[model samples]
Target: MSVFTAVTEDDLARWLGDYAVGRLVSFEGIAAGVQNSNFFVTTTLGRYVLTLFETVARADLPYYLHLTAHLAHHGLPVPAPVADRNNEYLGTLSGRPAALVRRLSGRWLTDPTPAHCTRVGAMLAGLHLAGQSYGRRQPHPRGAQWRAEVAERVLPHVGAEDAELLRTELAWQAQQDFDALPQGVIHADLFRDNVLWDGELIGGVIDFYFAGTDTLLFDLAVTVNDWCTMADGSLDAARSAALLEAYGDERAYTEHERRLWPAALRAAALRFWLSRIEDLHLPRSGEMVQVKDPNEYRRILVARIDGEARLPDRP
Candidate 1:
């Protein structure tokens, strides 16, 4: 959910009614993101997440809508879009195109253990397997892609050492074999906040705004980077194992995938590190949001690259 914009109840209810599957009962704002406004909406029929698009590319939304629907159809844990009576999935609400999705049940896990890591890994793998059947790919955006957003936004705001380390990492990444990784659809942003948990089980995965067709293993690497890397730059063995085993359960890896895994993990770490730094320096329009420190992940990435960290053994 994007929290950068202001959304009022009456403003949403009026627009929401046009596309709601049932009579609108109540709408409450959920302040938790930097790109879109979200509301926990209730109706005579069920609960749903009402989103007001604030700064998405607009034309690219169908990918998220269709992808979630596809995942739901394949029996993955994702909230499907609640269609209007006319079968319209996307509708104009408050002058912006919006959609209501079934609110997934679960909470953002505050304490993620190794077992949770494994479950998350498995869920991602299942999603990746399901995504292979999707037949569309959005054209790569022109100008700055997210990978470069760090240097463009954050480096200028901090100490020179941070900037220098980030720039060096970016240059090093530019020389890596990005295309050599396994290929398929990827959920580029599946952080802890995105995965909902019910006790030890992952109830659902939310926030598909960054879902796209990319390297399948790269997605796994991304998950491992987010869910397995610790604050002190060490890869937690049990957590890493859990995640890898979870992913392996859905999509078995090839020799090529195995060979590229380590580098991909390093690459994924750097990707988020840069994005965090970018957000720190370039504050988007939002009421003060807490931005994570990029240096932590930068240290994590360096440790992974230097063989100072080890991902758990996978068969």
Candidate 2:
């Protein structure tokens, strides 16, 4: 959520006239994320987040917008798209695909407690269940195929050790069979920054652009890798257990999922590591671009590879 396309007050005021969100009162560009141009917009009716697609193709926009709406309609706390007077969710603004979603209250939790992890775990499981009936079928955007393609682009910039790790992991992940695992629509990027919390309770989950159809275990792995880690990239056992426990209460993990947990954690780490490397070396131009450190996930990948951090067996 950075400023790639600038929207002036006058420009936005004109655009808002086409919608029933009331007149635009004030608007400011958000600078917390690396993808897309986001603005915190306030109108006579309520506060909202206006997003202009920067890199995502216009044709792929409907899957994300409607998926969010579906989850929200099922009582999941997510940002549902606001339809215009014509009852359309997609629109052209500033020559880019744009959308407006009701802004969820609360700030992101930077330093979370085990209680916070538990809440997010349960909410994520509920989200997965709610999305089972969604008719869309998009593959995980950052899955093994994407990682393999991106690895070729980033290998030139990394050291020999990092390059070897990338190649080895890509090949290993390719050989693994995930077809036996339960699959569904997943919030593939459910990092702490993407979830909002009012104190210990989850306010809402935001940023569904990365959501897609994937194994439920893979989604849990992506979440635990971020929410249950220490600064040194070591897994926090108590928090990880809490998260897994809460999630299991909603939908119990199958034996296959439990057996693949270790590998799934490594795959999640590799996905983010590869993406951060791409962003650092092959960045897109934006007024407020944020290039995160690839080494952070690199360390995490190494930790998952070297350490024995496994979820406890179901009781």
Q: Against the true structure, whose lDDT is highest?
A: 2
Error of 2 at 249 (Å): 1.3
Residue-wise C-alpha lDDT for candidate 2, range 1-315, written one tens digit per residue: 889998889989998898998998999999878889999999999999999999889999999999999999899889989999999999989999999999998889788788888898899999999989999889888877888899999999999999999999888878777778899999999999999887677888999988888888889999999999888898898889889899998898888787788889989999999999999999888889888888889888989988886666664
Task: Indicate the residue-level lDDT of 132 in model 1.
Answer: 81
Error of 2 at 11 (Å): 1.4
- Candidate 1 on 91-151: residue-level lDDT in tens? 7776777888999888987568988887887788888888889888863221125667646
Model 2 vs. true fold: TM: 0.98
What is the TM-score of each predicted model, taking all chains together? Answer: 0.90, 0.98
Candidate 1 has an lDDT of 0.74
CA lDDT of 137 in candidate 2?
87
